[model samples]
Target chain A: MILERQLRDELKQYASSQQCPPDMHARLRQQMEQAMGKGAFRPARFRRGVMAAAISAALLLPAAAFAGNPMLADRIYGSFEQLKKKMTAVTMEQYAALAGKLSGAQAQLGEKEYARYEALLKQYVRAAYEYGNGKGYIDFDALPAEKRAEMKQLLRELQPYFDRLNGERSAKEVLSPEAFDRYIEAQMTYQTVLAQAGIEAGQRFTSQDIPAHLRDRFEKAEAVIREVSRATDPRR
Target chain B: MNEWEVQQLLKRLAAGDLAAFDRIYEMTFQDVYRTLSLLLVNRGDIEDVMNEVYVGMWLSLPRYDPGRPFRYWLHGLIVRKAQDWRRKAWRRLRLLKRANWAKGTDGWTDDSVLAAETRQEVLTLVRRLPYKLRVVIILRYYHDYTLEEMAELLQIPLGTVKSRHHHALKKLRRQLEERPQGKVASTDDLGTTTT
Candidate 1:
């Protein structure tokens, strides 16, 4: 009897100390309903390579026996193959340009600030690369209701760090010429890290390298990207 | 609705009675919401979680075993949903980093220690256990259920529930013995599934 009483008292105290404020329920229900009404949300698409592939494919593909009797099919597949080769070259060039830009930005960080900045950059790059290729990009809105809420909550917790990082990045853009040159070296170091990590250029970014603090942003972004990819992917 | 009537309404809900769904919501929203708020512990995240829990319950209603009590099933759903929330937030990782966040509160109105004066020390102690163990303790004592009933409700093996119950209670007793301040009121009227 004493044991039971002790247990109850303990349990009740736990409950009382944790009384959830009312009114939270109505808001959650509304969000859920609104999300449901919208159907599944997709993530943003950053698939330049795929988009390039599709664009070139469309431009060269009027080969059927239409009333206009366009380009013939004997050379269509060959042309697509040639386009693929050219597309690969163009993608590499674009990646180099972007990496150069990022490298230029990185060289300006002071020695003291280098560690944290490098860590954050590596984390974001890893996350972005993984998000582009893997299931990391998700549509939380389209996820099972429970999973969606869970991800959203996770995203909520991680938003502050991401906002800070973005603000810091913009602020660094105003550095003097010499400072900007050093920043480029740091950016190049980041790109090297990405390459060493086996994330190929010209593909969508992934989330594998994301640090814990920024995981929520990566998760939210991934979910949104996946939703967009699903909505836009021709194969889907 | 009373327990039996709620069961009948759930049966209708299972068979596609949208009105019955609304009835069930009215019947249990308070209970579910209150529990979710406590488990989640964040005011900002609670509402979305509550709606998700309800939506999950709605989707899973068809599979709810009729042999079990509806409240037990509902309890299971709530626990699962709370776990789901914890997982996505990676709160489990964060929990290990920080000393438990849910501790040392001195809130008004529902002042936990004051309300359960006798159990206060033990309650405070149990709050420090890991999440899974904490759930077992909460379902066992605060909500009041037998070891077997808890297992069924949580859809785990009976032996697992028994082990957790035994371990949690033993920990509580040890903690309370060390403190020895609060009184122990009879909990015979406490809500228990066995009753």
Candidate 2:
């Protein structure tokens, strides 16, 4: 009983000192907005009619047809090109491959700081990558209702970008041709990873963030995006 | 807000009310953070996990029983999410070929003194306990769940929770016993997580 009391008291102290990030609600609100989409929460009867119509339209359309706006795709691709320089890759495997490039940066850090920074980086990547890749993670079709609803609670600023890669998504803000959409979304997601990494890395990583190996991924992901753009070009 | 009011907010939330979400978040974000902080030692994972927990709450809101206290329901969801997060973390480790990040955290957990003069220091020792044992301690002490409650929330047998609680306290007691002369002991074996 005494041991239990001591443990409880210690835990209570830790709990008292804890606080959440200030901007957590605002960020959540923004993500929920994107996930639900505008006009999605209309009256149930209206929603039913619209959903039925969508289903009908989907059935009528050719299997080759893809959803999303070219203009939006352009903006997404443009953003990726710009974002390539600022951040890192999506998975640890991707980053590990680029370890050599970050050696100079690692050399500057004290052992403890590097440990803390690297630990934070992994968490940041996992969180932001999971958050941004919400719908994309499941490919929409595979996501259970509970799982899909969970994604609705996460960041979806890259909804359109994620949709293309994941397959059969309904976002007006997307690019077309399943293959091309996949490419654009992949690059956008990569940039988003780097962008989140910048936040986690703080001053040091942001200052010396760009490594040649990561840059190659940028070129490849962007090159794919650009190629898709040319293929989807209305003028061509 | 009272349970009734929170239930009403949850209703609105299910209807896609962002205002209700914002309000519920205001009331519960601290608890959410504390619950996660206890479960996950990494500060960074807490923020991201908070995102999952809140969203999980929203998704799970439909099934929430208004008769029960909201806090317990929320804690249940948080524990489940942390479990999911831990599983994913192991998977994430596989992808990270050179998991040097795993370095600073893993050191000595074999017969290390955990005499902590300060509260934070002592808690660090608690954090060092293996994940299974550490979680039982946190759930029982920090979250204040009854053994039966933890068993229910964790979907494990009650006896297992009992044994783990006993095992953890025994491990902790061995470490918390101060060395002679009040001299500080080396932390070589004090790293979090032991087999």
Candidate 3:
């Protein structure tokens, strides 16, 4: 009991001495104000209110105008398609640039580098849509056996980049080495899950086949990718 | 700021008052930053995570209950964001490793080196604990959270929290008692004292 009390007191003393950066409050306030100004920090209720108003305004628009001008609807649809294509192109460019950098670099990257890598990975699904011979699928099985083998070999070649990226990222974000190792182990488990489900790189799988925890991770990964895609969309 | 003041600020923030948001930021940034610094090794990442936490809080403020402790909610959000950052980092690293990329050391800033040099031995050991135990210790000692509070915050049973706390202290005690005199062992993860 005495030892525990002593340890607690020592810890309390240490905690009291820890201080944040002197400029943290000022910087955070600036960021919060900026975010609020941009509507990025708007409460959900405000967004919903705005959305409701927009919907109401749209409903009030003349139905006769749309009925008389079929070309108007066509134009809107065409513009939407064009915007999507533009977004896909931008996302692809961003991913390709980051992936190329990772491919060429020999050294472990900093947080910025790891963030770029993450943003690139998040675009992987979109890249499949943009680059997969216009078939909207990453048809690895469609390739000749030799080509498939080459693709696998290329993935193998990229493994070290992934490892080093993890090492640097783990070093940056995770305080505990043991926790970082568990994260790596979780990645391995994800791979095992994929293998068991007969899923290969660039292939999609049914969410139902994934374990619950792994499925959550997979969904989060997709969400990150989608978020990156939206953030980089030129039309946005 | 007290809970009542924070709640008032949050109410104004939810009403779209930028000044209220700024006030909340001023009141809570230190606590948030300190918590993040202890959790994240990379100073740059800590700043990023801190920004993310604020943004997340702002986005979810409508659902926040004024009756609840704002600090607890904010801490929970920070923990979740940090975990997300960690997972993303791990995923990218695993991909690089699978590609056979040679691992190299990241370049450190002068500030980071100085910070590492100043880290206390006990803090270093605390950081070496497994994640589950480390979080419990950090909350109990660093944040001054009660064990019951920790159990509720972590969504774990009280028994689990007590077990983790016990295991963490035992590990710390063993590490301290077993150290040889005049020979300080280097910890790679703590980024401390070893060039």
Candidate 4:
């Protein structure tokens, strides 16, 4: 009993006597504001694949639209640089917070699987850089068919990641939930267009196209709608 | 802040009010700092993790459920950030090993600063305890949380939390026993390492 009382007294006394250094509040407040202003960031260690992942994120629609800016690696790199610039307008920390969720899924994978994911990330960046960057633009469709295959395979692997992260809060601050739904809905046609590059989903995988036999797929349709709802509606 | 007031602040925070975020940080800093000080050894780490908790609090406000106690929710974030620090420390240790840390070592501390902050032998002993045991002690005695509550907050089995608490108390008791009764402990007595 004495021991307990003494321990409690020491701890309580310490807590009551100590105050956080005064600078921390102002410094942290600045950081929070800065975080709020930036786009989502992955851990610096994982920032390598992020450029490719985000570049392809705009590729969520159609490859054809992005095709033929001359398919030069330099141009692709420049365009990638531009996309990264535009992405900065949104809050990176929030984006990183969301990406952090993917780490849980990543952690669950075996070492070899994670290595493969890393490899695919590199491949996607290469293909994007080399696709259509002769001088100064991007053209995803202009890439050779085999390169397109790489993107498709990459897409197949990334589908689950995209599904997990499909609860995308648009970086655009002004987009309303209803308007947001319309935004993604407009991409359905573009999804098919990108599918033309190679995703079988691009061809006929629209929500309306679910076959009668695959009962589980109705869940996909349901989940997509719900995620969008959750994204736009702030639960706080 | 009162429950209603905190809720109002949270609402303003979620709506993008920077002043509300500052208000929330000021309201919670001391408790958060004290809790973190118990869990971490490095002051720099405490600052980093506190930044995370507050920044995370701002980012996470939308998901905060008003129905539940706000302090518990905040503590949950605090504990998780501490765990993140633990994970990062392992990574840092690995880097230190790879880089061949020559000038300084893991036991390195600036005595003028660190010793002043952790002058108490009891606190030093507690900090030196293994991470699992240390956390249980901090949560139990410092925070005055029930084992059941610790289980829920830590998302561990109740039995696991109970065992950890029991083992932590036993270890602390043993440490206390080792000191020559009622005399100040020489640095050699406590030793340089913890199990």
Candidate 5:
């Protein structure tokens, strides 16, 4: 039996004109298909474990040795030892502290320190991503304008560092140091292109920029973080 | 013909098959449009809202669960969009009423031949009644949704639907009987109070 039979015909006649335009459907379908064909993004390459160390050795140490190359071997081993020490002790808190330092001294620092500071910034980013997307409370006004600008500039400078870190992590999984380096280099260049497009870390982020529905969530997160921080620091 | 075939069609449509989408659209478009037209009086507004309704349907098709009745889900979307339109329209009308001293009227009248005059007179009489009654008459007679289905779709009690149906028809009949070309009179006038 027909449902709502009387109004049915009239309503049907009225709704018939609402068909999707043929051109629009074709365009939408084409775009979706292209996205599907592109497929999933491959996970980033990283270097770790014993296999990672072996690959690092393969990359840092030359295959052929000269008669007096014993000193060179020792130097290479020393660098590896230092690298292992650096990677093992790195923590999220350390990255945040480094970020604090980088932002404070950004204006007065030279290019070499800037590069090192940018590497520290990359470490913070990796830690943030690792720590459940680092979706904590952020105070835009609390961050000094100069610090904000420095962070924006630092995003571009930190691209190579991010690439190297991602590569090292990926390489650690499969013992491919050369592959890791290539991946890192590609990412740095890609990020450079993105920087040219003028997208920056923490840019255009303000209370006004947030959508109405999400503002409540942001406020709650901020309040929660503030409470935690206050509890930790009795002087505050 | 069977429910299984309908389910298959819906799945294919969800998979981006254009032909299935069109079939589903054709099958459901009329009722959807009528529902919208009732909520919005302007033909142009109906056309715009209708497009939004179908576009919404298309966007939501992927999320359609095969077990649910597609028509019910589609109609639910139409009702939601129509309500949204009404809310916006009510805001605009309230502003307009404040600006102008004159009162607003309802229903349509397209001057033509045959029973056009009679239908227009009756429709105008129906529109002059309380909005709740008017909605019942429009949904019941104009759209032909059953009292039970109307109650279900509108989320009102079946008894309330019956009462509204009686009240609306009673008022329409009273108005029609009092008109100049009055013929048969309805004994049940809207003089009595409803609980």
Candidate 6:
């Protein structure tokens, strides 16, 4: 009991001495005010409108529109290559912008629209994967004619929506450049630390391997990916 | 502010009074900040997490139940947020590794410098504990949470809480005994071995 008491006392003393910086409250208050002013707390009707727009845009892609075209296989391969390159080259700024737009879409989307978007994205990923394995190079001629035609139709149907979703116009419509830049910078720092740790893309590591400081930023960026995955889950 | 006062402030906040939100922030910022600091060792993260906590508070005010202790709710949010943050970080790190990008060595901040510089042996040992054990110890000792409260706050079983607390103390005791301090003795010598 003596040792336990002593340990507790020592811990209490140490915890008591720990103080938050004096300016923390002021800074937090300012941020809260800014967020409120930007309708961060308000229900996002604008987000629903954007979701509606995206859904309408997606609905316009008729699979039959490009079905059975021999040249369709080449087009699908081209589009998949373009998307892979775009995803690879996405800067922190672009990612933040994309993430912000996604969050808005998540907030506003109805059950039907969400399900549609989810199915479309899943189909797009599968098509892209089969076409090029998510890497840049794809052998268009190697695919059988019927399979090629189907892949081409899927790509033609999905590519425009993907482009609009990832494009700057969509991101800029929802996120201010300043917020996008700030989030991106934080993301860059997080990615840099992961690189230093010799962690590769899609590799798994325990939380212990992460440095204490970068964890928050790392988590924020991860939330973006998770949000996308959750929205795109076919089961959902 | 007392529980009653806090509830009143929360009521005002629910009614969209920004001043009440400010008051609540002022009242609880220290405890919230300290709790986050202990849970997350990185000083930079503490501030960001703190900002997130208040924003979360504002967004969640409409769901607040005045009957329960506000501090309890706040602590629960902080713990959940911290865990979520850690989980996300781990996932992102994995994703980066899979991409086969060159290792980014630049811009990594040294967090040891940001962690509390404690010379006290006990404090150092507590800090060195694994994150799960450390959080249990901090909640028990620093925040004065009872074993039941700790279990509830952490959403774990009561037996699990007791085991973690027992294990943490045992580890600390063993470490202290191993040190060369003459006055500090073993658990056997002190006769304070907890079951």
- lDDT leader: 6
TM-scores for all candidates: the values are 0.46, 0.50, 0.48, 0.48, 0.37, 0.50
Give the per-residue lDDT digits (tens) of candidate 3, residues B81-125. Answer: 776665443232211101111112121112334336754555656
List, residue by residue over A1-236, the lDDT tens digit for candidate 1.
57666656755655565544455445444544544454452211232111111112122111111122112211222332332343332222222222332232233344445445444433432333333222112222234666534433333223222223222222123444454333332222333333334332322234554355555643453343333334333334
Please, what are the lDDT tens digits per residue for candidate 4 over residues B79-153? Answer: 888876554431221111011121212223322345377555566667667778778777777888888887777
State the lDDT at A189 in candidate 6: 43
- Order of candidate numbers by TM-score, starting with the best: 2, 6, 3, 4, 1, 5
Each model's C-alpha lDDT?
0.45, 0.49, 0.48, 0.51, 0.41, 0.52
Point out the worst 10-residue segment of candidate 2 chain A by lDDT: A44-53
DockQ for candidate 6: 0.12
Per-prediction DockQ comes to: 0.09, 0.17, 0.08, 0.13, 0.02, 0.12
Which TM-score does chain B of candidate 1 obtain?
Answer: 0.67
At residue A61, give the lDDT of candidate 4.
19
Candidate 2: clashing pairs of residues? A87-A194, A88-A194, B108-B189, B128-B192
Residue B145 displacement (Å), model 6: 1.8
Per-prediction TM-score, chain B alone: 0.67, 0.72, 0.76, 0.75, 0.64, 0.76
For every candidate, what is the interface RMSD in angstroms? 19.5, 16.0, 18.8, 17.3, 26.5, 14.7
Pairwise TM-score winner, candidates 4 and 5: 4
Model 2 chain B poorest ten-residue lDDT run: B90-99
Instruction: Judge candidate 6 at residue A10 and give its lDDT.
Output: 71
Query: Per-residue lDDT tens digits of candidate 4, residues A1-236?
Result: 44454556667666677668788887777766666666442111210111123433322211111122221222333343453443322222222322332243245455566556545555655654455232112233465768655665564454333333333233134356564444343222233223233322101133334344432433443344344434433321
User: Which stretches in model 5 have alpha-carbon errors above 4 Å?
Assistant: A1-236, B1-3, B59-68, B90-119, B126-135, B189-195
- lDDT, candidate 6, B4-43, per-residue tens: 9898888887666779878998888878877776776433
The residue-by-residue lDDT of candidate 5 on A1-236, one tens digit each, is 11123233433443353443335334334433443344431111111111111111112111111122222222322332443343332232222222332233343356676557545544433332332112211122334677534533444344333223322222223324554343333332322222233222212133454456555654454343223223222122
Give the per-residue lDDT of model 3 (tens digit) for A1-236. Answer: 43344445555555566576566556667666676777754311110001101111111111111112322222222332442353332222222222333333322466566455434442443333343333122334455667545534433333334435333221213224454333333333344344344433322235765667667755554343233323322233
Candidate 6 residue-wise lDDT, A1-236, digit = tens: 65666667777665577687777777667666766677646321111111211221121111111112322222222342444363353233222223333343333465566456556655544544555322222334456778756644554343334424432133223345564343333333444455444343323255556777767756675555334333332233
Better of 2 and 6 by DockQ: 2
| Candidate 3 clash figure, as a count | 21
What stretches of model 6 exceed 4 Å from their correct place?
A38-236, B90-117, B180-195
